[model samples]
Target: MAETTNGDARGASEQGAGEATNPQQFTIQKIYLKDSSVETPGAPEVFTQSWKPEARVELNTRRNTVGEGLYEVVLTVTVTATVEERTAYLCEVHQAGLFTVAGFESNATDQLLGAYCPGVLFPYAREAVSDLTGKAGFPPMTLSPVNFDALYARQRQREAASAESADDQETDNPG
Candidate 1:
């Protein structure tokens, strides 16, 4: 009986060690430029204008499950440069990456996909926008770095507040 108990204990320990060695895995499968477009409608005329262009940048991120433990995260960046209220140029870039994230809870996975993935892809998107502007006969537009973590947190807060307000309104109306 004592020998059998000792053997069982050893087997459990070995199982635990095996699990430790093969811990939860997270990896990036690939990163690529999913799509990109540059529109210089004003073109030659805009180029002739002074270099004082007002630049507007919009950024968004989306994620979808590709397969088990695999997800596709796309970071879309749109840049529009205007001069004297006329359109100078418009560029959009969709930077995407395939990530394998396993052994994480739903909330953690959400954060990873929403914030961390976009943070990783932002620099590439930024560079693409800059290159597009430079290639469009204009100086490269330097974009400031974004804090995706903070943005994600704020977005979550707003969502929660909206939900709470909706619940309050429903209770007040009771219809």
Candidate 2:
């Protein structure tokens, strides 16, 4: 009986040691320019105008799980230039990056995709937008820094509040 117990303990220790030595593996499968467009309506003449151009920028980000541990993050940036309501140019760019994640659970993966990945991708996207706009005969547009983590937390809080309100409404209307 003592021999059997000693063997069992050794087997358990071996299993644990094996698990600890298992390598963490990950790879960036691909990174590509998903989409890009530059529209300059007042192209040739817009460059001659002495008036300062005002720029409006909009940004969006999304992520998709390509495989078990592979995820693709897309950052979309749109910039529009106007001189007192006269459209000068519009440029939109979608830059994407592929990432491999290991040892993270589902919720953790989601947070990484939503916040961390976007944060990593934003700078490249911003630079691309600025370069495109500059080549399109407009002033370089610098994008402001984005706090994706705070944005994600705020979204989660809003969702929870909305769900609670929905539950209350359902209870009030129950026949």
Candidate 3:
């Protein structure tokens, strides 16, 4: 136990020294709901039908650099519910966060902006969706938790595959 404690202390000291050379920083300046919209196109008539509504949910994430070492990440969630051929309710929420990240490699920063930051913002977006739906005279739409890391990995894989295919085509045809 004592050896483990000493080793941990040594590791901490080493990391501290490393941080001094290239200081790493990460902070969330603010998290807010950037935009939201709820529409109930078919109100009284749609509610009269059986409560069997087909719900479709779409989610997307985007990031942009606001300033040096500062970035804005937005998670957009859209939900539409329809009863038979009639529209029930449509809700959209854009949850955004301002993050400051420095001293990290490009890939790390991308991961932070794509996955980690969005992961932090997702719950708020989900809650907003549910709240909006409930307030629109419908049952709360409880959204399932998202696996941002897995989604990011899949997206990266698809991009890499596309690039490889483009490179292969170029090599095959030299015009």
Candidate 4:
């Protein structure tokens, strides 16, 4: 009887240990340049202008579910540089990566995809933009490092605010 009791205790302990273990995973499957374009509309005439280039840069990130536990993140960057209020060059780059993520809650997964993955891809996109600018006869454009974590948090705040506003409107209308 004592032996039976001991065996049952051991089995329960083993089950508890198994239940407490966490199997979390994050892996980078691949990284690549998904798309890119460079245009020098001003060309020769723009080159003659003084090198006082005024540039505008826009950045965006998006994610897609590739398959079970697999995800794709794309970081898009656009740069337009003008000399003397005339267009000198325009560059756009899309850097993408495939990742395998699992064992996390939905919110955690979203953060990983929205912030961490894009952060990982930014350097590649930045380099591509710089290379494209240099190739377009302009100085290499060094993009400043981005804080994706902050961006993600801010985005979430905006979404929450928007939802609250919608809810308020619905409550007021009682529809």
The best candidate by lDDT is 3
Clashing pairs in 2: none
* lDDT per residue as tens, model 4, 1-175: 9999999999999988876796678999999999999999999998777788899999898888999999999999999988888889999999999999999999999999999999999999999999988888788999999999999999999999999999999999995
Per-candidate TM equals: 0.88, 0.79, 0.87, 0.88
Residue pairs with backbone atoms closer than 3 Å in model 1 (clashes): none
- Candidate 3 lDDT: 0.94
For every model shown, the clashing-pair count is 0, 0, 0, 0
Q: Specify the poorest-scoring 10-residue window by lDDT in model 4.
A: 15-24
* Ranked by TM-score, top first: 1, 4, 3, 2
Candidate 1, RMSD to the unseen true structure: 3.7
Residue 129 error, candidate 3, Å: 0.4
lDDT per residue (tens digit) for residues 1-175 in model 2: 9999999999999999987786454455666789988998886777788858888888788888887788888988888888868789898989899999877667777788788887887888888888988787667778999999998888889999999999999999996
lDDT of 1 by residue, 73-155 (tens): 99999999889999898999999999999888789889999999999999899899889878877888778999999999999
TM-score between model 1 and native: 0.88
Candidate 4 positional error at 115, Å: 0.5
lDDT score for candidate 1 against the true structure: 0.91
The global C-alpha lDDT for each of the candidates, from Candidate 1 onward, is 0.91, 0.83, 0.94, 0.93
